[model samples]
Target: MSDKNDSATVLPEVTFSTFVLSLASSALVHLGEVPNPETGNTSRNEALARNAIDVLTMLDDKTRNGLTPEESKLMRDVLYELRMKFVARS
Candidate 1:
């Protein structure tokens, strides 16, 4: 039998879309829209949420015309959804 960590989980592949989604997820957590996976609690912190959203926006701007269509759309959609949540929480 091989000695290996059977409980080790595989990580998701890194891609522009996945990166965008991760950032959006963080924004959602900060907005108290999604529970923190680590704590199983939701709490609003507009500053952190806005910072995450802003970082996403900046990433999109800096990567314009450099991403695949799907990636671009993913970024746009994630930003839109996060923005709406941020607004609602405000």
Candidate 2:
């Protein structure tokens, strides 16, 4: 049996939202909207940012009718925010 007080040992559960958020954050970095964690500088790369956004769009299409309502909304919101940011930064 596991102990009740194991919060320190337990890791956060991975979910679709977390995955999408990770990609979105990376895309923002590529678009120079966020700084590169390693370099402490923002490097604008539209190609990479667009690619990431495309990947997310593909995921949205492929996962249609498969995600919960909340999950679907989160994915849409993230994509919208990323796209808008990409456009503004371009």
Candidate 2 local accuracy as lDDT? 0.91
Tally clashing residue pairs in candidate 1.
0
lDDT leader: 2
lDDT of 1 by residue, 1-90 (tens): 434785476668888777888988899899998899999998989999999999999999999989989888888889898888889889
What are the lDDT scores of the predictions, listed in order?
A: 0.90, 0.91
* Model 2 ranges off by over 4 Å: 1-12
Q: Over 4 Å off in model 1, which ranges?
A: 1-7
Q: Please give the range of 10 consecutive residues that has the lowest summed lDDT in model 1.
A: 1-10
Looking at model 2, the pairs that clash are none
Q: What does candidate 2's lDDT look like per residue over 1-90, in tens digits? A: 567798569755679888998899899999998899999997899999999999999999999899999999999999999989988988
* Model 2 worst lDDT run, 10 consecutive residues: 4-13
Q: On a 0 to 100 scale, what is the lDDT of residue 61 in model 1?
A: 97
TM-scores for the candidates: 0.89, 0.83
